[model samples]
Target chain A: ENRNNVDSNFKNYLINLKNLLFIYLYQFLISLKIVFSSFIHRLIALCHPEKSIKNQIVLITGSGGYLGRHLALEFAKRNAILVLWDVNEDANRQTVEQLKSQGFFKIYPFKVDLTDQKAIKSTAERIRLTLGHVSVVLMVAAASFKAKSILDTNFEQDIEMHFKISYLSQLWLIQEFLQPMINKNWGHFLTVSSNSALIDMPLISSYASFKLAQTKLIETLREELIFNGIDGVKTTIAYPSILKG
Target chain B: ENRNNVDSNFKNYLINLKNLLFIYLYQFLISLKIVFSSFIHRLIALCHPEKSIKNQIVLITGSGGYLGRHLALEFAKRNAILVLWDVNEDANRQTVEQLKSQGFFKIYPFKVDLTDQKAIKSTAERIRLTLGHVSVVLMVAAASFKAKSILDTNFEQDIEMHFKISYLSQLWLIQEFLQPMINKNWGHFLTVSSNSALIDMPLISSYASFKLAQTKLIETLREELIFNGIDGVKTTIAYPSILKG
Candidate 1:
């Protein structure tokens, strides 16, 4: 009897261990599935907007900068209601003018500093009120620079600029602009981001560091808001190398 | 003579035409190269870190939170310095205590409010004083629960908290920690980011927005800092699904 009991107990322990391992594996696989699906879906949405993107208001921030302008034009060409937000009023104006000449009426230019919460909120509110709903937001605005070494990098100024212009502003914009889409059961946000967030580089410490933080913030946010996607809100990110002279 | 003059004019016109065509083609090829290389390289970095982790720090931020704690432990096991920065005193203490018990003396902890510039600066300076050089800085600390929906998210508070903790903190840490690393020639900054930044979610608009912004910021930053990896510092990012829950 004692021998039987020992055997049974050992068998049960193995069974439980097997079950736990399976459960863990399942979760891991599921999470991976979700990630890959989300990523592929986003690419399709961005590259082939013509296939289908209904009831979506696309907001492209920093539409003035080289990257921002290119993305803004792409979104505009896709017939997206492009909201061009930039701190550089002149650049924003130039983009707006060019778009206007190109017959882009859906394009809205807002000269707002991404660093300022109030500015972001006000602008988002304006878009919500006027546009009725925003389905996609493309955060393509940011500060950029190059350097030989991190020691030579303007640690304070450059890094601060990255956080304010690149990182923080997107948060403010979403807080102010995204509720209606959530309620309506349809929205997607797209941002132009960088691979630098993953790998580290010498001169652009500020840029890479800030980008890394933002990446994680979204990862957790994805889990907490899975139900929200069920409500029709999807967030997407694009990490492209900078294209500039 | 008139025919000869006409021929010369035609020749000049043809030369001008060729020049214009050459310029246009060059521009087109450049754009294509930029888009394709960036897209492929970023995808490679995201999908295959081990194969491509040249000089990246491969950071895991929020090294003091519940998930951050586990991540820090994992990183430590793998020989990471365990750059543990957090706002939670107890959490940081618990992590440090636990790690110390496990024989991890290299775990570095700091109490910091990501939003407070002074705090960020001071903490950074303290980090610099302690860890002379670091390349990759993970952004892990973030405001939670109150992390609201974009619409429900407070304008001033949401942006302040998100950017300060999630975005700005990265900037400050990198500026202070990476100077020496850059001089020595390398780093990688990864984040324990959410899938939400991977896709926009409705409920956690604040989190999503901040994450999205950070994502976008890093994407652009990478463009300018490409040489960091080859020259000295490299940047890379990972968008993991929630860890084995």
Candidate 2:
């Protein structure tokens, strides 16, 4: 009787092992399906072209800068209404003239310092009054790169300016413009981040720190939008590596 | 002759394929060896205990707060000299007294606001003068938590305070103290960061942004140290989940 009991116990253990193997195999197959489907979806998206931005009211910060000006020109070519903001009044006016020369007439230029909260708010209000609600915001502002060791960088001046432009200004602008996008559930938010934000390099601690913070903020905002079921609002972060222009 | 050429080409292709497979197998073996060694090293570290902090001059920011006080007591048990910094004068003095009552006599308490750059510089100088060089710096200070949406949070007051205490102050302190550590090439810098820095949760946008910046700064600092071949200067970032205290 004892021998029979031992045999039955061994048989039961094998049966339990089989059941566990079946469960694991089922889960593995499900995960593989998910991976394959996502790959196919991405392949399809790569083959298809994106939608046109014509007739969209797009706001571009740092419109006087190299990347910003090019982005503005691209949107203008697409027939999107452009609202250009820059601290340099002369450079901003030059951008406006360039756009006009290209035969794009719907351009509004604002020479306002983004570091100032009040300036950002007032300018955002003015833009809303003039151009209706903005459908896209492209944050492209950044402080001049100070290539110095962390020890040599001035905390109050250089580092503070970097944080103000790269991080604080972005936060303020998002707050100023995100309400309309949330209300309508249709908008695009894009920011040009640097590869330094991803790789930790020496001699640019302040810049890297702020850029990383900006990237994290946008990622958080994306999660919040998705959680709220605002699928129409899209976010993109471009990490450009050492652009000459 | 064409069929002969095809056969020869197929044979050569098989030979090339074999060579490629062999190279890949060799690389795969090397990678597996590296991964296994690192895993074993980590497992050993987990099993073994940490080194004692005796005879180390440890500086604790926000020593009046919950985690800071506990860390102080722990180091005190290990017979390390404690330098406590806090903005709250009474609470800092209370911590000193508490340490004294617990029979840890080598405790220095300073009441200075970390947000003030001048205050940080002056106090850091005083600590160097009085207690010699600190071998460990524990950055545990943070702005008081304000539970509000990003829009509701005041840009000038609340958000500014968050940046001041969280990112700027830490930067200032590191600037003031890091030189000596670099010279000696032996020290430890640890900071208590929030899990919010890693995962972007809704609300606490200001706090999360700064915390994320702080985390990135430390990571960058670590890379700098490694690049400079100062391996003795260790850095640790503790991401504690929600704490009741």
**CAPRI tier of model 1:** incorrect
In lDDT terms, how accurate is model 1? 0.62
Q: Choose the strongest candidate by lDDT.
A: 2
User: Which stretch of 10 consecutive residues in model 1 chain A shows the poorest summed lDDT?
Assistant: A222-231
TM-score of 2: 0.79
lDDT string, candidate 2, B1-245, tens digits? 99999998897677656645654575467556656765887799899788667888999999998888888999999999999999998878888888899999999899889878999989889988978998999999888777666556666767778788888888787898899999998889898888777655655777888888898788778766755556678888877667777
Candidate 2, A163: how far from true, in Å?
Answer: 1.5
lDDT for model 2 comes to: 0.82
In the range B60-94, model 1's lDDT, one tens digit per residue, is 45666777787667766766665666777787898
Q: How far is candidate 1 from the true structure (C-alpha RMSD, Å)?
A: 22.1
Runs in model 1 lying further than 4 Å from the true structure = A1-56, A146-156, A229-231, B1-245
Candidate 2: regions farther than 4 A off: A1-49, B1-44, B47-52
What C-alpha lDDT, on a 0 to 100 scale, does residue B122 get in candidate 2? 93
Task: Sort candidate 2 into its docking category.
Answer: incorrect
In Å, residue A152's CA in model 2 sits off its true spot by 1.5
Q: DockQ, in order, for the candidates?
A: 0.04, 0.18
